[model samples]
Target: MRTWYEGAIRGFGMLVLLSGVGLAGATAARAASLDPAMLPKIQAATFEVVQAKPTGDTLSYERPLPLELLPYQERTDKYYSIGTAFAIGHNRYVTAGHVLLAGEASLWGPPELRDAAGRVYPIGKIEKFSLGKDFVVFTLAQPPAGDAALEVDASPALNQVVYAVGNALGTGVVIRDGLYTSDTPEQENGAWKWMRFSAAASPGNSGGPLLDKDGKLIGVVLMKSANENLNYALPIHEVLDAPSGNAEMESRIAYQLDLFDTVENSQLKARFALPVGLGDFYREFQSRIDANSDAQLKALLARESANLFPSGAGSARLLHQQTQLDGFPTLIVRGSDGEWRRAGGQAQRFALDGNGYVATGAVANNGLVRLRRPDGVAAATFYGDAKSRMDLLARTGMFQRAVAGEKVKITSLGKPVRESTHLDRWRRPWHVAVWPLPYANALVMAYSLPVPDGSVMLVRFTPPAHEHDTMLDLAEISSFVHVTYQGTLAQWKDFLGNPALQPATLKGIRIDFDYDHRFSYTSPRVAFSYPSTLQAVKPDNLLWLGFRFFLDGGKPVWDVGDVNVWKDTASDDHNNVNVQRYVAPPPGLDDDLSGRWRKLAEREYPYNGVARYENDLMKINAVVAPAAAGSQPSTVLYTAFYGTAGTQPQADMKGKLDLLTKDMRVTEH
Candidate 1:
């Protein structure tokens, strides 16, 4: 079915005209007018329903215009002509419910109508509206003088010649003649039927009055079927024959508003809060299982189960453990009975057992466990860390491909439904959504909760058939699952007993050097040893001194060590180094420099200042010392070796940095 908005045109092709034989009777009747005597009255009653400053909040009802036509089309302050409304009584006007509801969310003001002479009339309080029937009636705040209401025909007959009068494409109200073809039941609620016609009602003809040969109102034009000339209208008697009491109308309005609010809220939540891509995984897995033979499917499930519940871990004793996952720090705790358990941020805790690791809270399936309901629904939860940024949209698209597989056609079932972020009993925030799978008989629901240290846990539930409502099941499972950490038994053993985990051991490094070229760099407040092959370059502002180093090939390298000694710079009081810089101190000297310098360095640099920065391209180190008793100022010695950001400098390069900063001195100029 197509809406009346011009934008609702779905394709670029011109409208295909149906054979004239089917519409011959109506075409001949057009010359005789519905009624020559009532023509003037019908024209006067019909007005162009133009909404100036159309509300922007509502979704666009029109189809995207072709790129070529867009440039020549005039930009209008007015939205599409919302079909048409005609005076039914002294000041009462009637139109389609959809036309008004489309703008109800962001309507600028009261809707207004324009007559053939270009006179505008404002609409007043809506007298009645019914979403079920797609009809609305309101009073004109200022009725046009001598504008009599159109008479309503309680009955409209099929095959009878009729006239459709309304603004066609916003040009003006034009009466089009056609024959009443047949009636079809409304799709949503089949309690009533719609009158089909062969009239050429365009985008602006919706809500216009459908008149019998006598010029009496028979129905209201609403929409047309795509690929055919068949149009539809609501019987006029449904509105005129119904009671017009304010209480009944108000009740109907309230019902429609409540329903609309629910739908809008659901759509908004889905757009922003729900986790994406889970549906694709579940759908694909289901399709794979369905296509395989029963024996093969069982084998597949067994393999998945094994991967999810590996047996190598068995059970292990707890020892001192230090590990980070999903941005959260975790600890290994030993129970009185000697069994080990992991616990830390976000209620992350799991028992070490041979029966497969079970979470203290929500179940953290090991990515392979296939969950099945008595109803044949299968579910799986995949755990992954967002350690490196991953595009959610791209991930979801990949899942779509998996589900579509080799031959099945996939159709989107509207948009995904999003629910508000709900906190589980463990107090973890989870984003959830229920998505209809492209499959004819299945639905996939999923929720994702955050883990510490930049990680995410996703759980997906897929029902066996689309008929099943898995929403409640998803909610129950998600609420019960707890965050958990899993690892091999060896990893746990090393975590608990390894002395290398100690802070001092982790930060310690040793260096020895044999210098090829050595010279002292002396500034006003400090002096440092650097390679004589390095060229000293002074900054234009004299804020610091730079030593340019070269590779063996004599190509100039930009990674240079800089020294700055200034009495007034705030950083002078405390050794300051950019986080990107690497620093390394001699084994025992880590705490030897008055303890103050060591404390500051450790607090500001990674690896507690032992190494300020190290990457594949280079490694850097710095040393700072305060001046004696009333000397000039504190001094800083900095050095770097060629390397990349993700790797460490070679042993030879490391030794150079140690020797370069060795013998660094702070003395008064």
Candidate 2:
């Protein structure tokens, strides 16, 4: 879970939670002088927008809710506050548009209003909405019977003492007083004027009433000023005079894509008839959200098309380069010199229960987690159980459930809302699962690949409203993920047998092992079999197989390119063997590598082609596979090597290979 500082509420957007921190002045100095009847009327009209408490908590906190910070009675309430809303008469209530939008895709019960007496009222319809001005007007399904609405006064005098009333710090309605400091032009345009005041605006105060000395409503508190105590409020006239029959929302969203240092600006505007049910409005708003986001994405890409991949000199060089494929995903950036290179953070391991560890690398807008399958969990069970997989990730702290900017206990995501698979560029099948975060209007996605020991997971968040585009985008980006899969032969058997986790590209691959001392790996390009003497073939032995890209008839294809098998032990001294697909140099390459390539091709054409060498530091035995019709400038070089730890006994290379290849069968396309 992430840590949040109170004054600067990071994750909850503009819903900042400010407690009794140092204000512009002391509480006594900020108190207002209002008529005795005014406070009661103001309090009655103002209601705290909230969501009903769930029957049981899906969220568990690192510590219990800070109940000690609140009054005894409020420590355990039936509802939690979201923001403030107040009656404007005529069954219409007003609040900050963002406050209402918080409920847009939330799983928390739809936005409701709680009165000073603790009575909860349902919101009926969204009568009017405006994203640009940040104000919303809606009708209450069952407004309490009484004359609780405050009188609207559009032209309250400047420099007059006023009370900013709302659920400050979520401790009921707080009336902090200050002067109407001045008038300022709204940032978007000078089309409207905002009432600047000296009173402090807490997070829950977003849609509260700004009352004059006589209790006349002048404005609705909206935001805190960044540079000064002159907080901003939308003049009541704006919300009161918005077009009556239709709800129009227009906003200019400043958005940027992850990994690329570029921004896309787009204006989103929509209009629909008022008196519409909350559900219909939500559908319309979500539709517009996708259209606007799509425009921004397209424009972001189109603006940099010329310098993008496959277009500029940087991209051309990158395409010609052979990437080393066994690392976390990274951003391919174009340098000032027109060269492309990968950028990423080093991996850091966080220990979890059992032998499992969460190996993480920091990246923008997304998370990368490599979980070491815990010692006791069965590989087959982990791969087949979706809830169990997510529950394991929940413990990693990256998968979380939060409220009021505080991290909570997340035993599980409950269940995945959707599950599917996407085959990455290397033909590795990535299982994709999405869980809803209705409270946040977003969804958490886990794109995972099951390996021998655990899973290589790519995680990110998206608005569930944008599901279609988000899924497509996720599939496209999956091509960039880089990870390695390795474990015991027993683990591999369990991993490969799950059809739900396998993609068609992996259908042609085969891995088999038996207690009878036989082991083998097969693919469309090559098939090979060897006995235990080749490299100790046991259920517990470690094996690593990875893929690499090659130009097949000038069109690139990924196939088995590297293989490793070894008897891993507690001590550093151990024997290992591998077969690597070594590509020959292209034109203009350096001479040293060219010479090495020549020797390898020559070694393959004639002779038994077995090579062996020994030195003070290590022992080596190797051979190059014979050329075939479809074989490229790439050659398969096999090696069995063991380090001597300077003075330890060196392996008898010739003796090991003699027994290794004695019963080996090889096939090449």
Candidate 3:
């Protein structure tokens, strides 16, 4: 997904498509004689650029293979090979500016030089740089022991034989020969020119020196046209002749780098925070793994696996595998012998061998079974369901196929347990059953709960005889499983119509604000909580609701104050609550807030000891309380309405307001 300018090679072909502009035919220039004596001086001037300790993290897309297979290739700690640089002036070197700035904020580190003998010389400061021209000039703290500097030639004729020397892929310094192809104007402006060549250039060839036959430096190789041998280099005259006294260049570089840093931070926040669509979520997850170092990648994968299976009583060790099918996240569960896979794009079908077992089509694969029961039986099964009535005698044949022709009896059955949580109303119903299989010497317990759209979630538990006294709580394990429906109604109906199958969308469930911590603002005077889902307009100054109802249009509805809380009015309603705290004004300003209560006893209409005020726009409930004895009074005000004068407060708005007001308390300074 990276663009051509982003230094990724996949989009390099586009460069050739744009190469035909502003080029004209010219006669080839005569070749100059090679100076054998100058070869040693040119080689001595060339050095490999390296970053000993990189400050920025390196992000790579290629998946790493085992390095042990190639014993000769050893991994190095060096994070960046920013192409090559050579001495242009006394203790001065020049390189392609992009080699230093290509990755945005993802590229950072103090640059140094690795000479032919492996000696490192650190760069002292940046002397000059031109981002548009892709060239930089810097001085070294300690110059290498070489007095020779390549003289810059401002003009090179077309088709002149040139020598390109630089570190190729960071392997070593290499010299390649080719003809100076032509000239083209720089893309940004016609103020500068580029020397086109037919020389070979790879990633690490950037910032290297382009030398004429007489060994005079003419251009600095910057990039190669994608899908062709045509390479581009910036004339060395630009770097040598550019004004070095420009006062704003340093600040400009800092500003651009800072922008890149901000973008990287935003990307990290989106990956770990917020709800992204299915495709983006998977891509972001994979990209993180690919970018991480070996040690970091391994740790992240292990943590992800642990989240899929949490430890609890009677919990089965299920192997989980996930893949995207039809752009939706699909999950596969594997047991000892049986495994689940997609069947005809409708539902998941379990392929079980002779050792596997199944209950009725309605409650298939929902529960676990035990090989042994507490009564020392050979085999037993436990089953639970939310949809079916809790009757032990009616479902005795639930596991008839598993223990074929064997005797089994229902030992005990529990009443259906109704469950409710903060996120949903009390509608979940489930029951448990324990059965003994004498032929197999095992006990089975089945527990099930109803899922969305009239489907049942079942769990089967089979514990050993000694652990029989310590019953495994199947209800607790079932509570953690989450099922989501993504298909159309016809597809959903088709899935529900088939009792023997389940959808592949059943996997780890995510809850809003479950993984994210609340954004809390605490000062010496006050403190409160707001869901992390809200975008902070001025962080602690204002918070905006990320989503809107049908009536809200596209405008941002938000709140501002020391501590505030906002919630939807009700189910299928557009109204919401906006609570703000107002501290009592100085002695002279009390008259402006005419309806504000001075104390709890002054109000005639007080519900649960909180005063109320009503206007055409909203209903305000205020509770005046002191921060401490003899301190100024503070009023916690709860207002229920929607967007300036849009909708009336719902009938139960006061009840919801009271819940938020109860948590609002004055803090001691």
Candidate 4:
């Protein structure tokens, strides 16, 4: 959203960086080899911080794992190496706060320690923690027998030899020597200096010990300089002198909602009693961070209150504006003038087997994709079927390749980890789902709305912490999602019969179909019923219903604006009839159609007219029906610019128009 905004709810994003790729908050410097006697102790004291084995494998992988992912064995390992931690005292261990926090809310199981021989030990109490400093001191549930703790060196001479040791790249413990470089102030408040070393530390080295020439702890390696081999490590004294039973988490947080680039910065400061188990500490940490996020969001909302939606002058203008008939969700943006404008993405299409295709594009931070049902898939199965929905989505080439650094073949997406439903501003129900990207520290979220033939979907990948904020954004945006259902009469019958398969919005809609006898559709705003003889909806007949959003009594609303029915082109010659609604002519512009409707609407009785424009390509015909804004009607010149279209009595079009309009009703409000 902005250069300053990391957009991960708060600073937990910092953890993803510290423990990913070849990143390290460490530095390099001169090194002198340690005495041979220290080798065994060094290895024994360090441990790989990993997630304990889960009860079961939840993911279904492609058979004969993708060749590009050469070492799929590690990808399937029960233990997931997160970072490094080392013995600092009898039963006590130290690691980066970020490393330990990764397991918070993770499905990967609790954090534990893996020794040189792969034996595992559960982690115990979190004795101390510092978010800003990025270090943690804790204990093991069961310490290795007779294992020695590393010696501490509070201050090591600059330019002296040092070693950065840990489970570098999850390949097991490794020792890399370098020089003790400069001392730089920690970025947030610079309350203390961090020992910068030139050690070749990598992602897995975080929480590992940076040792002096004598094998004593110089610092706890945390992160690497953005552009250099020099890395950062927390001084050992910071941990040694800290209160044993407290957590001091203070970090500078910057944030911005996805809609705009406006940013707000705040320092999150919270202190709570610790020396407690990891679960208890995490609960307190998350609670405080959530509060901080609320404050930041409130501040941003307050600053923009005068220009926000539905309450500002800009909102008034948008509400008064005419409906955009193009059915696709759009982003509501505030321009520099503080005027609200709709931002819609360009349509992009991808082909699939049969006549199936996917049309999608980006709307600001969100990617919007729309797909029509494939011929082989049943309409019943496509509705409210999570597995089939995601599978169809994956076929659109959205998410099937690499997660983190490993590439795996994806024949199927399996199922979402979480699934739920949300009702939009229009009262339409939408499907929401979240799928975890194994090892990626991220999630793929899908917001889907079912249409007659297919669905309109919103997809995005977010850092785990961002889910709450993202969901709120998606929920509001769903109201702006434009959709028009179109499908074969056969598909519609099967689809309309299942209320449980419909979103709440569709639940209120009723479709009566007496095969080869009668067909009718009724919604809150419109209704039409016709016998098979008037408009025969054979099993293969096609029907289209388009919805549009407009303001009714200054309140935004969405309803049917267009309806079209036609004979199946596959079995018959082109034949169609359509009825469209035009909202009342807004003040100002007086276009020809608006002027015609205004004049016709002035009649005392219901107005009716017909026109024919014949061309070499084809013959066109239309009938106009206009009536007064009924009891609750809107001046919405949508004031009777409405009517019905059906296979008319070819010989008496006028008589047919009168009959059809009598059987149909369209309300502009």
Candidate 5:
């Protein structure tokens, strides 16, 4: 069961080496004793019953024309819907990061998958989805019957006959066969390359299943090619065996809340979008599916049916208000008129006060009713406008005080906004503004303001409540500043020595970055020399520009400036302008710099401006004058890095390293 070195074929004729064993590319002969009827049974067994939705606008493939052997034969030129997904234990599934995220994300490689019944399920918990490797793991709110899920097997034989099962071009479940080609080296979104025998795969098959001859799970069907037989798959085991993150249910829920929190300093919640509140409940549900204990699953379902609300709020009212989803618990509160009510409970009071506060709470089993306070509202407001009400609640430590109190001075940490807020002309880019430090309660928010044309002013903000003592300290926040002069590793040493910046002591450091380069040149043809040969001679010579930056863990980290080569489009040329702009900032300061730059771009450019400058660095090109072209070098590029700096020199120090230069023969762009 060990994964063969020649893992399997992937990405349109691409072959890859598996992690454990090496084998020849010769295809395995079909098992002569294999039962053809088993194909459907095996297909059912090997196939993972997926319950999913499009991460975006996936093409809905048309069914095969009435008489054709192929499903999309007539629709070849048209688009088909596709999605990415994975199996959970034995009867569940998962998908890519983008699938469940809505809005602009649909443009990116979003989530796309469906259940056995052809019913699309709402993505529930995206426990582990990462752009670093272009993989995501999620669960459906409800599980579908009939089709069972597949398990992940890390090891597989090389040169094995493998088949992929997917909703190719929306033609239902299509099975394609292929060989395990190779495993991608280093880090890449298409982590493991796959190549297959059948041509059934299309863009819609990504994250599908690639099974072995015996129908045991093997890899995930991902990429495909125009040539009918070429396709790729990600090794299934690698995905399952990869690190399981520590993201918790509450944290994830809080993460979701943060997305719409309207709080100025919330980024963690914004970056990742998934169901946070119900993640744990869904996890428990998934556990039931994996164990195959239908009775236990039913028991869990009964728990789900248990009232989340208190009694006397109306038991029959709640009983008549239930809505059932296939996988998860659904309760729809309704009005006396029978129309579905969006409110949580039946007897709840709803009103928005001048302070924009709403009050609601449920009674506990102890007969004590508890009050739910709206975010950012003063506690004193619970018993009128007096602060004594808050003190009383504090002393009572009881959340169930609906009694009226005298006019009290109400206070809170600070008022929160319902709408998005921006700080114009900030000190640094907004992206890296705040970071959760080692100490609890302590936060390091950095910003950069536009200085002169070529420079930027950087600054850091620690909340006023950041007490030096550990008594109130949560996480001790720190920063690192590394600056590279123009893109050379030598800049690393230079920034390390600068007096203005100090690297944070002991803990690890990272670099964030932003860079821009522009150039122009004319074609290399002399005037009048081509007059007679105008019909045969080409006038314009292609002008090219290139750029690149080194990044690790999405953060510009180490120094590998030594990996130099001829600057091509992929390396750094006219074709790679977009790539050039994606430079990772040098350790420490890069994070802050990126954030500051993002804010600046948001303010200066505003609305959709981020799309224009999405790259970590940017490059522009134009034709140079022929005479000046000879005088000037054909290649030019810029490099930069930032590290640590700030008030708590021992903690908040971060900086950057940068440089710009030209290439004659073409080296690192």
Candidate 6:
């Protein structure tokens, strides 16, 4: 069934082999103090092997382990190959079996021979022996070096002094003295057997020669264990004493080489599976975290914990953990059996309270506070995937906008304390900010109360739109969200789970526009532009408008607008305030959008026939158009904002949309 070439390839692939080029390039200079007289022989034995990885940069191979670390050893970049080799044959050479067998496939399709000068010769013939036997024999199609071949011995005396030479983990060739100890077979993979010795070995040391007292080849050095002085070598005796009739070695080498190609191909696939964009973002985030002070970071963490409510049956808690595995933070839970497992998804919503003793959030029908400890221990029962918890929390409504210069309070068993400050919400329900905090640890439990209250507090209020003061270098672009609210502050105290807040005090505040909002809407009359490539995919007129009104310190309350305002107002005072228009329909889709303007107020209407204030309004024409082809062609338009009689006069805004036509250029408008 299998051809001779395949068999040779298989055999060659099973054992590691090094190239003479890498060995020759090793840092022999570092060993200069040992003996210059022996330098030529060491150099002569050195070789370099160039291994081309499927996706990463090629790795360079070396011979004899360098006495000192080499550039390759300290290289952080991914390499394709590992070490070097030496001249063992006219075209034939000796190298470690492990190098060839490192992966599922071999570097050489079949056994290959390399000379001290760097020429390569494919093995025309090859022979393989058992693990204890260690050595393989091969005939090269051509000679790589003209140097005379070294003799091989079938057996060498135990505890005899020997010089093992080969690329030791890509280091240059150098001699080290050690005693031949013992031979041990590996249990997991039987193909490789250990040649125990006192000499040290590195990654590039594979496929090197172990010479006896007379400089005759005895075995091929392979690896060393960190825990012990044991080293491994393949016995050269087997190659010199194989049965004359057995001749499948070369074929095996060829098959093995082919396997190397298969392995490299799989490596390429794995390399590309990672998301590069996300990786870049992560780097930026890490930089920010490193720059922040510890104290500020602690407060930021507490706020983040506040937004993420508890889920399932558990009091909410914020916990943190670090991992050996790289990348973003992950949550894990220890099972009842004491095994750490990823926490369930349902538990992620909760927050830590009462010194993190209980987890609490929006609980289901069953009353229970589910939780997981930072060390992955299950503090309470869980029923969801912990991995997706952060994702869900990041997408929360609280992070949609920033609440600045506002009075916020929280209270638990203690009195409520309030403060006036600015708060920026993340795009997700929960926010993870890099603030300054002294604690090096990750988890904490905190509670919110009415302004100035130290007790637990639940807030029930909605966010509002704040006017941009254009004269003060403030312009509200489509990319930013502005919020302003004149409302009473809500207060709640001494409660767990979800507490309720009642209107307590009126406080006026304005939040600066942040360039984080994701939604955008343009008047019908404005024109839009995009990159030429994207023009075909995204046309125009994709508008989505949403607004909210909440108590000074509250959650984002989406609108039923003007209707709610009028309903809450006293009937006698409603006429004076022109509240009748609160129930008006939303603005139309076309240029005349007065009705839509009326709906922006958070008011509600129960009956349809009511003629809300019909006489007081101005109309503006708006349109959106596509961009033409050009390097930086753009569409520009003027938009107007207006409100009812009693409201403040809205400002006029101008905008431009740009579409780049060139390839590989940044997109800007």
List clash counts for every candidate, in order.
Answer: 42, 3, 32, 28, 130, 171
TM of each candidate vs. truth: 0.37, 0.79, 0.37, 0.78, 0.29, 0.31
Residue 347 CA error for candidate 1 (Å)?
39
Q: TM-score of model 1 relative to the true fold?
A: 0.37
Per-residue accuracy of model 2 over 1-669 as CA lDDT, tens digit each: 111011112222343322211111101112437876566677778888887644444433355654465544444565667678898886889998777766665656777888877788999988888776777899888879986899989888999988888777666677888899988875555668878899877767878889888889999897774556778788999998888767666665655544455566656667778777777877777777666666766777688777654355454444433335453445455555755555564477767776677777756666777777776887767887777877776776755544345656666677787898787655677888988764454688878877666887777787555565565555655565544556667667777777666545457888788754877767765555667655566776767765544454544565656666655523233555555455555556557556655655666321233433334333444444533536364443433233332343323545555555454333442
User: Compared with the true structure, what per-residue lDDT tens digits does model 6 show for residues 1-669?
Assistant: 012112222322243233222223334442323345555665665554444323421211122223234444433322333444455656455444334333212222223333344454544433332222333344445654457555666678788777766555454455666788877655423544455677656566666667666666777776555456667676776555555323222111111110011111100000011112222322432232222222232333354343322211111111111112211112222233433233312233433332122233321111112222221322121112222222222223222211133322211111111222112231111111111111111111111211111111111111000001110001101001111111111101111112122111111111111122211112222212222222121111111111222211233322211111111112222221111111112233223233333333222131211223334532122221123325643322111221123322223211111121111121112
Q: Provide the overall lDDT of each model, using Cα atoms, as 2-decimal numbers.
A: 0.42, 0.65, 0.42, 0.68, 0.30, 0.30
Query: Candidate 5 on 1-669: residue-level lDDT in tens?
Result: 011011122222343211110111111222344446445544343222232222332111122112233234322312224443545653346543222221111222223234333344444555564332334565556644555556445687776666766655444455666566545442213444433444346544555667677666776665555444555555666567655543221111110100011111111111223434234533432342223222322343244333312112322332222111111111223234433222322233333322121122221110111122332443234322222222222232222211123222222112111111122211111112233221111233322111101111122323222212111111111111111112122222233333222212101222211112222111111111111111111111111112112223333222212111112212332212110122223334435555633433333332121222223322222111122335543222222111111122211111101011121112222
Error of 1 at 324 (Å): 16
505: Cα error in model 3, Å: 29
Top candidate (TM-score): 2
Q: Give me the runs in candidate 6 sitting further than 4 Å from their true place.
A: 1-46, 52-81, 84-90, 101-142, 145-147, 185-193, 240-669
Best by lDDT: 4
> Lowest lDDT 10-mer window, candidate 4?
1-10
| Lowest summed lDDT window (length 10), candidate 1 | 18-27
How much does candidate 2 score in TM-score? 0.79
- Tens-digit lDDT track of model 3 for 1-669: 011123222223355211110111111122234566776777688877765443322211123324334223223333345567889878888887655443222223445667766677876656665545666677777787657688878777778889877777556666778899888875433556788897676667788899987788999988787767888888888887876633111111100110011111111111232233223332433343234322332343344333222221111212111111121111222223332232112133222232221223222223322110111211112222322222322244333322223333332233322332211111233444444332222344444432222223343433222112212223333433333322222223333344333322121111122224443434333444334333222211222221100101222111123222223212112222343333333233325343343433253343233323344344434443434636533333322222223334454445445444444444532
What residue pairs are clashing in model 2? 60-409, 106-438, 107-438
Predicted candidate 2: what Cα RMSD to the true structure?
A: 6.1
* Model 4 backbone overlap count: 28
Better of 1 and 6 by TM-score: 1
**lDDT, model 2, position 217:** 94
